[model samples]
Target chain A: MSKHLLIVSTSTVYGKGYLGYMEEEIKNFFGENKNIVFIPYARPGGISHDEYTEIARKKFEELGLSVKGIHEFENPKKAIAEADGFFTGGGNTYVLLKQLYENGLIEPLRNAVENGKPYMGTSAGSNITGLSICTTNDMPIVYPPSFKALQLVPFNINPHYLDPNPDSKHMGETRETRIKEFHFFNDQPVVGIREGSWLEVMGEDVTLCGELSARIFEQGKEPYEVPTGSKIKF
Target chain B: MSKHLLIVSTSTVYGKGYLGYMEEEIKNFFGENKNIVFIPYARPGGISHDEYTEIARKKFEELGLSVKGIHEFENPKKAIAEADGFFTGGGNTYVLLKQLYENGLIEPLRNAVENGKPYMGTSAGSNITGLSICTTNDMPIVYPPSFKALQLVPFNINPHYLDPNPDSKHMGETRETRIKEFHFFNDQPVVGIREGSWLEVMGEDVTLCGELSARIFEQGKEPYEVPTGSKIKF
Candidate 1:
């Protein structure tokens, strides 16, 4: 496994506004050979494979990066071994995890990444890289046999977060409060990632991408916000 | 503090509806007169103090339990300290946790429960008894200075569950799948309390209630469900 990696937020769809810094980071990570053995199979949000593959294909074309075959390998064994690096796309993280776990691909992917194969997870893809898939907001539209995630990353990641809703009179519990409640019972950090941002990890060190500001929470301390340009080491 | 505690799921409206079994449990834990104090101060979900207090007053009336005036004390310090046992009501858990944290009632409540005060957290009330306050589906209509909860229950609880969406197309993650995904980052169990169902904890042991079922999850295992008659040890 190669140590270089990039977990994207979402692959551009026909060139809307670009996630400038994040796109640049991907280029920087891969450097000269931006070409990748793209695996778009993780688009498990009930989206059709054609549409999902097209999203990635367009990105590579638009970004001026070299195109590689979009692998349609259905089984995990074939897909995991033949790849140099992997980039799983975003959609329904539950679906992504379900496919990976059901096919027994989680460990294989982990091994591939550990041995230095560059593994990049985007959105739903990014969700599976974590130790538990608990942080995702993706609705489980379908039912899988079990509820387990690829236990790779040590902490849970909450992607695409805005601040707490201020005006909804529900005053009930907000998503933030709910997550905080999770921390109260269990001591684990749930990384709240804003749009256009993703986590880049090498070995154990993880860096915040795109936006410098993100909120990090553990169980015992006060909930603090990460300021722009601050170095967050975990 | 009494060791035997009976946490009611509701007072009426939703009674969260199981006063009869709860009464039996309360009596089973200690005799009927366990010196119960109504901790109505935790209904934090955006309701005005007057509205919350009214709900408290009503719960008191229907449950036939005297209101010990925890909310009226003005000082959480005096009220929480004076109370020997507690009965938390159901409402918006985020609001309840916010009020509890803002008023500095969390510590007192934690102490009382940990020291064996027979803490009974129902619905929103039960949610606060856990670690943090982020697992709820309720909106955060209000903001207190902090996001903290009384660290009593081990996992985040989602009380008052009904039917699932009828027309849903997303795959892999069902309503249940999404909550299980939350467990990836949060190791504490996510207890799904379907109406009359609840969790009855005594010392090191805990039991499930209601004729319905509850869902619980840990790190590595699948999200397994427990029915009304199940006894789960967390």
Candidate 2:
């Protein structure tokens, strides 16, 4: 039987060590289930699966959760099928997309989700939840010459949102400005997921989670925030 | 023989609209030489060649630089070879990569520069000068599912460096903080190109240009600013 789909967003893991809140969030998804099928192969720029998976194993164990190491699986397709709902740990989302594309796992994951698996995405993982993966914070880790993401959600996800940097010199333009620039070139609504915050979608219902709020920006209007447990509507 | 390569960085364009500056710059490049072959096909991502060329034509005319018209070339490789040195105006650097990659112009353009033909990337154009095209504000307009840019420079570039947004919730995390997130994952230094400032490469020398200063950030240390015309070691 297909399990619930859980996607751990890309930004939730190890961002400058800023993602300290990740374990609690991950546990929320895991709940009573101790064995998490770990996918630590998302780190880009030649990060070995062993490196990220071991890191995840340690972190999950530290959280008192048993980890079923899935990074060892060469074919993510079959591996994905064998697992319950999967947990996508965070890292460079672009790198993750590159892997998904290179390995051709996008369709398989979608199929599994449609088959009724619970999904949780953190940071970059969360980024892939949107309609277009264009809103991620991942530096085009590797240039396939363009940006391509797993379109799980119907909107773009911007992870790790926080207050602006004090020392920044780009006047009137914050990361918000940057995403607005992204919107200017396109017509997609961007979902800005701040640190400690995420949007959880279960069945037809989407709820926001975390300490801060998630902001959604559309054309010719102000960016508004979606409070925790609130459904994001276009 | 080929006249001196005239490249205009996007500092002027992305800001207050610079038809006059662009016209003057073009004049400086092709003084008395009406044989100037114009190319404005580098703005990538579903941006029609006609639309891209139209922007160039309109801007040149508005700035008073007399020009016949922009050459609408779909195949950048053929356009690049048959034409003189190229001029990459700014918009979306990642989008530019899409067009360049689809039309197979990356290697040919690199070869052209290697053979001593002038190549300039303004804004997004200037952005392509770096190792990858992840630097620009252009979101993925289309889904070729790649961001591999023409690595003309050794480091990464951040264009349209605007100041932080005061109302933003991302506290303690300025643009530097956000970019710092990238540093946590990779070892590359991000060059924040403030408006009016640019990095120019001639032969073996890569120098900064413009009236505004730039910020350079690595993983461990605090970010630093590089004055105009300064040569960055990293």
Candidate 3:
């Protein structure tokens, strides 16, 4: 049993239906894991856990898998230990991480995933699989106990990463600028995954998937782009 | 002696020099308070404290006020206590608040502003005047002891607020969507101030300043627009 994870930048890309862009990848990643537990903690639009879970349930059902919301379980930790696979949807990272900590599911989920239970996450969900949730673009609507996240991966992930629009007059810090600021106080490497991009992790091996290249930022070096299908070294 | 504060959305608007757009307001707010302490902890682009202070020094110099970085003082608490006024420049809000807490300056600075020393903040600076830093747009580059802020105002401030761009195909959450999510967990009212807009706080009066209208979001209610010069009631 080795680690298996599909860390996605977003659940849906522009002009695509929910999880439509990655239907093939989702099918291949989960492979025969029929009983999937959905972690809907990152409730987009501030919807209830049950509502968010239904969205994932329908999508997973289309893939011939049965989905149950983790919130629906009598004991979430016990559910995680018994589930064959997991799918965490996208929403506010602060809310998601906070709920994860409050429910005492961080260690249980981390243990399950590390012990070869397949896990898939998108957006805020994908962000939590990293070293910390510091690079997430979601607002800190709620403060989590700590910024520490399940270190499923060695570095942090910046999901839905966008390049600076040179033509815009907006003065807000661009994604690149934000990551540079993170480097000032942090020493972790961050992978900036664009929409439709994801990281495929199999045991100790992690590779960039989808058609776009990822921008890599290290503490003291210039950010560079790693092409699709390349191993995410560092 | 009243609460004299200038909470601005941005330091530099497009096509304007740093602090140039609000030159008149800055002068009027400070009003003969010649000795000002500068909080440069929010170090934009990871610049050194001295370098960040130099930028503020030159700008305030043009306004006929001498500025010194709070870091230059032997005791930061004492510095805040004695300065006639203060100016905190725009950068990462998390960094600013973290440094403030680490140096034990939150209480002293809050006391100074509450006791009639004129205080001004742009972007991240403006954010600290709010109830909490949970609404800030900056990355959590550094974690502070708490999300609690100066609490100089009853509500939260969303500085450099941008409306949704209808023409864009990007999949990221808009500023409006982000604020809506914030209301899901937090009860504080949020003032979404545009780049050129600011709040003028005088004692118990908190009025919307500048030419643009601000979008106000309260928990469980539809967000609405309040025009310039209007008092931000709730």
Per-model i-RMS: 11.2, 6.6, 0.7
DockQ scores for all predicted structures: 0.05, 0.25, 0.86
Q: Which residue segments of model 2 deviate by more than 4 Å?
A: A1-25, A44-48, A74-78, A143-150, A161-189, A218-223, B1-10, B13-64, B67-86, B100-119, B129-137, B144-195, B203-205, B210-234
lDDT of 2 by residue, B28-79 (tens): 5444433223445444333565676666656655544433223454544566
| Candidate 3 structure quality by residue, lDDT tens digits, B41-101 | 9999999999999999998899899999999999999889889999999899999999999
Instruction: Give a tens-digit lDDT track for model 1, residues A1-234.
Output: 335455555443223443334565665665555555565555543456677666666765666665343446665477567765666777666456656666777677778777777766667777666666655665433334444455566777766555674643222345576566555434557777766666677776677766547778777766677764444565
Per-residue C-alpha lDDT of model 2 across residues A1-234, encoded as one tens digit per residue: 343433333343333453466666667766776656666655633456777667667777777776555657766677777766666767666667766777777778777766766666666666766666777655554544235455666667777764566765433235566676666567778877766666766665567766667788896688887777677777
Model 3 — TM-score against the truth? 0.99
In candidate 3, stretches whose alpha carbon ends up further than 4 angstroms from where it belongs are: none
The Cα error of candidate 3 at residue B45, in Å, is: 0.9
Which candidate number has the best TM-score? 3
Report the CAPRI category for model 2.
Answer: acceptable
Model 2 chain B weakest 10-residue run by lDDT? B2-11
State the lDDT of candidate 3 residue by residue for A45-104, as single tens digits: 999998988888888899888899999999999889889999999999999999999999
Best of the two (1, 2) by DockQ: 2
Show pairs that collide, candidate 3.
Answer: none
What's the ranking of the predictions by DockQ, best on top?
Answer: 3, 2, 1
The global C-alpha lDDT for each of the candidates, from Candidate 1 onward, is 0.59, 0.61, 0.93
Give per-model TM-scores. Answer: 0.52, 0.70, 0.99
